[model samples]
Target: MKGKNALEMCARAEYGEMRGKNAFEMCAEAGYGEMKGKNALEMCAGAGYGEMKGKNAFEMCAGAGYGGMRGKNAFEMCARAE
Candidate 1:
């Protein structure tokens, strides 16, 4: 269990460092990867808008999925593919 936990932490830390972003930026509410800064539901509104457009959560929240979906993050820009 400890090893698993450590591995998870290591992966997270490495992910944060991949794009020169810190813990906060990587975990930003509006998302940190590609979405960067969309503030409307449109980011996660339709399809292939936010997630597919941004770098991380922005991929699942505001731009990743349909009726879009982190890959976007959160509710606003949940529509990308980070």
Candidate 2:
């Protein structure tokens, strides 16, 4: 677990170094969940999620489902939680 965490930290550091401003900006807009293990509730509170339109929200929901954010109420709950 420690090794895995170290690897993840290294990956995050490399990602930040490579992506620079764009990555940080996107992370700030979308929420740390995109980069870390943030909960669905926290993600829902982010500005990017709030700024999404109907179609975009639907697409995001679909993606989230495939990405392990299961449950019918998850998206709505997250959004409302925000």
Candidate 3:
């Protein structure tokens, strides 16, 4: 997705007010943001997934590197990472 789509997802994922999602879930779906998880964070950051969302550190790394999580390009790349 484009930067605008990432920004929109970030707006919808505001802390504590997420619509049907937790931080990890929202961050993963937004395609950018920071969460916790060393392996995942590094990979996501390297891929520039969260950069568009203004995330200082990449979040949802675990999701992007694993299955059972949602992200666009990152999700597709999970296969190789895993």
Best by TM-score: 3
lDDT per residue for candidate 3 within 14-74, as digits (tens), equals 4654455533455455433343332333434544454333233334433443454345343
- Each model's Cα RMSD: 9.8, 11.1, 10.9
Model 3 — which ten-residue stretch has the worst lDDT? 73-82
TM-score of each: 0.19, 0.20, 0.23
| Candidate 3 displacement at residue 76 in angstroms | 9.0
Kindly list the per-residue Cα lDDT of model 1 for residues 23-52, writing each as its tens digit. Answer: 334443335345455433333332244334
What TM-score number comes out for model 3? 0.23
Query: How does residue 73 of candidate 1 score in lDDT?
Result: 38
Tell me how far the alpha carbon of residue 40 in candidate 1 is from the true structure, in angstroms, after superposition.
12
lDDT of 2 at 62: 44
User: RMSD to the native, candidate 1?
Assistant: 9.8
* lDDT (10s digit) by residue, model 2, range 34-82: 5343333343343254333222323545445433334323334233321
Please tell me which model should have the higher TM-score, number 1 or number 2. 2
